[model samples]
Target: MNRKFWSIGLLAAVMLISAGCGQKPGAAPDNTPEQVTPAPGGQTGQGNEDPTSGAGGASTGNEVTKPETKTESIKSYYTDPDVMELVEGTANISYKEDQDKYEAAYQTLQKSDNPDMIPLWEKIEMKSLKFDNGTITIDVHVPDEANLGAGGEAFAIDAIKKTFFQFDEVKSIQLLVDGQQAESLMGHVDLEYPMTR
Candidate 1:
């Protein structure tokens, strides 16, 4: 999938800035291991690892360039089947220098290193996802095979929100079915468009 992305440094810098905003001015950014920001008000994202592993930046064309990779530390958020709450895990995604980091991060959220957590987006499919000026527009299509019941819908949304919001560069999200706006992704919850952090 072709995706646009802000530099990993930019994403981290945004996260650092936003993380500091919730605290006193000049305060340090929060990296609490077990931090959990409730849903609907998910102002914080799950990432805590320093995004300092970036190497080469975005490239263009089919020009043969140096073989370099960008390794970004990501926060993986999954739903706990037993507790019904989000379980957090740290993951590292390495992609081609010209590849989109957001795509790697999104894929990381699909499953967890911890087996106890359930992948929130295992069955759902995203047609397209784009990020611009702090907003992420996600065009999704859920097939009947997913069977994401009412409760499952809530968990999926929460997990997705928290997973992306962990990046301070993302200020809001606009969810769409196919390519148009909708009240809900699965006719379960009242999905408010342009959901803010």
Candidate 2:
């Protein structure tokens, strides 16, 4: 009624000067402005990471994992080809014993002490020895007055070709002095040729 108290004191002084120019209570509060959550890859932890990756700025904490490959097996037991074919078929040639090599080559040509070859090998006699292929025929038994000269028949053919070529499959010798084939058994070592040493 006094113009309605001067229009309610000019609308309460324009709402106290628009609430004193807005906010004030330890301020920065403008209704909706606290959403500043953008520091990953939008990258702002201030510098030095993507200069083509020295990998130090972006990862906020735990992730390093890696280990898995395995494989291994090459095998042995002395090259087991079924135990090397049973030690190469029991080390070849197994004659199950008893071959004192032609009775030690007829007791080394009957103990030769050469008394003109002791009555020509006291009636020389071996008769059948046989080895073949790698040679060893022997069959001696020569009689007819056991002739012995030319160094007692080259010491009974170099003591039966050095005692059956000391066997390893007898590599040579063939003298058949009595069963034939003779060009010299007392003139110079050559029982129809086959000695090989």
Candidate 3:
């Protein structure tokens, strides 16, 4: 939509940062296959080339695969590097005592040359951020008369999720508008009031 509207999304991003106090981030993308493919016929491909075994194997449906072991990784709420640049470079933002590392990181991030990020970065209104055990929360505010736009809410959440997921400390995120959950920030996406990462 317009700058004023997108500003809201930027503010939300800042609020997310504020919530987090001093944590690293989250884990990496899930790589362990969540779904397994079954063979054509009733057979196994564990160690043989039996035709009856099909290609891979048969569905025993007896074993239960466990989730991947937890690894030391960072989680982020923001994905767009450009958006992160806005959050990092906005001189309006203030930090808690321990959030300095993230601030520094943002400083470097501001110098990132990813061109795709330019537009999104310019439209946001970054505020303050905090990092706790892992979750990073930023506090933000949009001009009362802004017009965020369709899908603005989703865009905002996706940005945060992508950004914080980069670290390992963050696990979840929450969004607040002027301090409360509301309907779509614009008209396309749902904030779901207090979104989680």
Candidate 4:
């Protein structure tokens, strides 16, 4: 009886070791790269051939490409005397570069409208825009300071600030009048320092 038990135990251990060594019937070997599904419109992974490629598996080079562009709809502010507050108007702008976007914003601010809003940018010309370290510096050519009204000056600054600050990248603004920094715009808000959003 003891000899029979020992033989059965040894046979069971051998069967278990052999079972661990071999793969199941249909399993594939490991370390294989995963198959990637092709992107729509006949685009495939880099260095991979597109199955839908024309004769001889050669690319037709007629794939539709999307334009690289950045666009934003910004609001320009104007003052309403009835409410004694700033009113906003929207302008859609598309640009390939950041400078173009800034120019578009300035142009939108200069547009004229009726009693609901005041256009303070009529006499002001945007000279340049500089962005550095989350701050934007805008240089403008202003007509004679003496001719600028106090109310207009304040509304102009507010409109400019509201326009640029619409972008999340802009944290503060430094205003320059004709390449020189002034103490204030018509004795209203100080332009000597940068204004935060």
Residues 4-107, candidate 2, lDDT per residue (tens digit)?
99999999999998898774643544564322333766554434335433354444433232233322221111111221210100111223222434544455
Model 2 residue 197 CA deviation (Å) reads 19
Off by over 4 Å in 2: 1-98, 108-130, 137-151, 158-187, 195-197
Clashing pairs in 1: 45-165, 45-166
The residue ranges of model 1 lying beyond 4 angstroms of the native Cα positions read 1-67, 96-99
TM-score to true structure, per model: 0.61, 0.20, 0.39, 0.59
For all the candidates, what are their Cα RMSDs to the real structure? 24.3, 35.2, 31.2, 11.5
17-119: candidate 3 lDDT, tens digit per residue: 8766434333323463544434455433243344443334554454445334332222222224333332322222233334665543333322334444333
lDDT of 4 by residue, 1-197 (tens): 99999999999999998897665633644554453334665445544565666865546665445447888877887666643566788777787778778887888877755656666676677788888888888887776843346666777788888888888898999998778888876666666468887
Lowest-lDDT window of 10 residues in candidate 3?
Answer: 85-94
- Superposed on all Cα atoms, model 2 deviates from the true structure by an RMSD in Å of 35.2
Q: Where does candidate 4 clash, by residue pair? A: none
TM-score for predicted model 2 compared with the true structure: 0.20
What candidate 4 gets wrong by more than 4 Å, as runs, is 1-69, 81-84, 113-115, 145-148
lDDT of each: 0.72, 0.51, 0.46, 0.73
